[model samples]
Target: MQKIPYTTINGGSVPMMILSVFSMITFTSVYGFDSVWTEWWWTYDGFSGPAWWGTKWPICTMGRYQSPIDILPDKLLFDPNLTGVVFSSEKKINGNLTNTGNDITLFVDDVIVPLINATSGPLQYVYHLHHIKLHFGHDEASGSEHTVNGQAFPAEIQLYMFNADLYANYTQAMSSPNGLVAVSIFLEVGKIGNEAYTMISNALTHIPTKGQQHRVHGLPLSVLLPQTKEYITYEGSLTQPQCQETVTWVIFNKPIYITEQQLTQLRNVNKEGGSHLLIFGNIRPSQPMYNRLVRTNINFRPKTKVCSMVKEVFYEVNTVQTRSGR
Candidate 1:
């Protein structure tokens, strides 16, 4: 990590470590500017895998509020106060999609791009879209970071937004309280391909290796999201380094669709130094619940599948409402 030199009263230079609030890292798969073009510091396996994250960033092991939790339908509390998240998307947004070595990340040009933000439903302050990270596994059965009753999706799109009302920039917001809102949308393989995702897939050829970037222009941000806004909300930490517990996670209840061909393209993207080894399995394992509260607006009584595995979790659900309120 390169430290910028700070000039003191005596004109002497002092090394200062970059202290980004959220990991000072918006994410693993990320959200802030501090680590836009940094080299691969940590990994998904081997010596620097998730298991060893705490050795360098202690919060990964010590923190009570970790992320990527397996959401059991039976272990969810239905919050009447919870409505859909209020999203404001730019009609057309411009950004650069970069292969950040470990994950593919998209960062918007805040200057040229009109403000794309979201508020309400578990959010207290207005959050500005900072970055987007794509996480996947080597195969279909093990890609998504967050699982449902131990069932993982093909991929996960993590849209990291920082509180614009509370902080000046993504870097500053990442370190503050009520700092970030990570909107997670799962991707399922389907016959039809989402146009927004198609645009991304087409652009993948331009950035076939690490540290490469492709300019994406005139993209409809709303097209990237599913029609439904219903989601499960929780208070958790970033899935990356520093693992700050300042994030509010909004995981969409409904999944967006993508094509199998697109999935293959992502799996084909080469890792650092343009090695033949494709970039795959960049997801983090699910963390402990730690007695944290998980809230949702979706009523699942009629749709609930009996999962005896989740018998010990604590939650509140309206039996009468689900039975009568259709």
Candidate 2:
């Protein structure tokens, strides 16, 4: 090679030293070398694909192993021994039916349940009964967490209880997977002649609209449970916001009836400090069925399938199918 001029650094002229400095600058991008290096690396055959980019930075995508699943009938199992369903007949408050934002607390008594067996593979935990309450909305079709098939019920009575002993409060039970269980009861319309109606109807006068408060007692919880212990059970999350995935849902197959006047009274309650919350409907769209299972206890009579119930009613009356085909 021809003789080359050596670069001077400090007090020395060293060719290798100059080359080392240049290489370092090239890699570090002290000059324009860093950009060139990045372009070269990114264009390399094995490193240029989307897979490589994804491996480096994952985006919002569902993972097959931990994807979200939907609650379906097949995933549920019914148990019969879980019976003695009773509705409370106590009415604790009486005031303006529309404005009263009273917290109606109902007690569940003699609910005998078993400890959740988490060691049993998929059916690890069995959710026990807890107390339930109502969050009133301003419409006939709203206020419940779920609907029968697709129809929204007038009011939703959320029976709250946890896996822990019935003595435990909601705060304690919600802390763990085995802590809480809620049975949701949807209130429908029409006359069924239930004694429990007096408990709620008596208080309607006190709950007029938003910002009103009423205090009452003696509301029974048993009146809301299905006559048959046969209920569809599944692993689900609380229907409220910040939906925790710890709830074991037991939705009664049978629905309680309410009068049109009673439903109107419920629709006038205040919601979240706003105007009387006119909740026309409250329910989530049915989700896709995953590989989960729903089981019912064997002691009680089997409940009619929700689909069949809808079909029978529609056909019996020869009711014209609405555009939505409900």
Best-matching candidate per TM-score: 1
The reply for model 1, stretches above 4 Å from the true place, is 1-39, 112-114, 301-326
lDDT minimum window of 10 residues, candidate 1? 317-326
Alpha-carbon error at 315 in model 2, in Å?
Answer: 16
249: Cα error in model 1, Å: 0.4
Across 194-272, the per-residue lDDT of candidate 2 in tens digits comes to 4566566666466544455454444434554546544455566554322455666666656677777777665554433
TM-score for candidate 2, residues paired by index: 0.53
TM-score against truth, every candidate: 0.81, 0.53
Cα-lDDT of candidate 1: 0.79
Q: What is the Cα-based lDDT of residue 87 in candidate 2?
A: 30
Task: For residues 162-245, write the lDDT of model 1, one tens digit per residue.
Answer: 998878888898778999999998888889988888888888898888889999987777998878756888898889777888
